[model samples]
Target: MQEKFVINIGRQIGSGGRTVGELIARRLGVKLYDKELINLAAEESGLSPEIFEKADEKESKGLFPTLMGYLRAPFAGDDGGCTNVLSSEALFQIQSDVIRSVAARESCIFVGRCADYILREHPRAVSVFITADDACRIRRIRNRSGCTEEQARATMARIDAKRAAYYNYFSSRTWGVASTYHLCLNSSVLGEEGSADLILEFAARKLNTKF
Candidate 1:
């Protein structure tokens, strides 16, 4: 019997993480789940796509004070505020459930969204953290988003901050710290294609261990 493997990728923004994940999925003949998870969560929660988009892999920083109106405290609020909280929580539940469903369905590559924590019990799962040099990441961001280096750097920091906050809020493990992942790779070291090949080779060997 051929044993299945799950690859959960945690990556920095503009670090070629998604590109490598897609290539790894293609080479391994597995499904790739990233943005598609958002759609699935929205459908499951019966929420508007915009709500999910706003809450996607993000931490709720609490509601606005002025928006709460006469509502005194955070807990004391109108139906709209309550509804917003409920919808956001519902979306998160759906996302977590969908992630579990995909892991159970088959071997697949999951990019981000605390997938490593989601599949921690899976026997053949490999958790990886992808990052690159600041220069490389800034350049990539600039090219992709047409922003200046300073803007790109700020954007990168902002997005990564959100991701870190979300992950930390949801999971006990820390993000980007060496102890959190089984393996950490710098995409700039080998380029995107080369990094993909290296990861494939490593995963293949790990998968073959039971053979």
Candidate 2:
């Protein structure tokens, strides 16, 4: 078995998934990759981090991203314009590379960005999806964003649609479906810490490791 392992987390916006992933990583003494993938992809691709971030998670609707970003980007050519633009698809590819590279280097927890699919063939990778009931989600969102219940519901719908679209576009599997992941958890049922403990127990058994 491979010494390095990865736990890929798919989370709803207010599900406390990222927080739980952090807890797991801390327990295992491993890094967590989330928005940090943008910086890593930027470094590897020699493009501005802003460019990669704009194309993040969403599927490419066209052949190229707008040149507006390159106008202020340091990498713009001598004519003060972009020499090339990477579509959302291209950026996804680069980010996927960064994901694989990091996971190979050491064990880590990855939050969102379809990491479960990206590392599907890894010898010791575990895939998990997290969800929460509307009440729990509304409370979490209100506390975090100061949004009212209706507004929080709106935000959740908007973001979840985008995430499902992105995941479906890039992978063969469906998002948030039980069959799509090795395990699934309801953050509301167990709360964040309890949910995390259950995940640890499940993953440790699958990975044959102690936590």
lDDT of 2: 0.87
Whole-model lDDT values for every prediction: 0.81, 0.87
Residues 46-122 of candidate 2: C-alpha lDDT, one tens digit per residue? 88798877777665666365555533464666686546676677678888999999988898999989899999999
lDDT of 1 by residue, 46-120 (tens): 555676677777864551122322223334535545443343444566688989888887889999998998789
Show model 2 residue runs off by greater than 4 Å: 62-76
Steric clashes per prediction: 0, 0
TM-score of model number 1: 0.85
Worst 10 residues of 1 by lDDT: 63-72
Best by TM-score: 2
For candidate 2, the 10 contiguous residues with the lowest summed lDDT are: 63-72
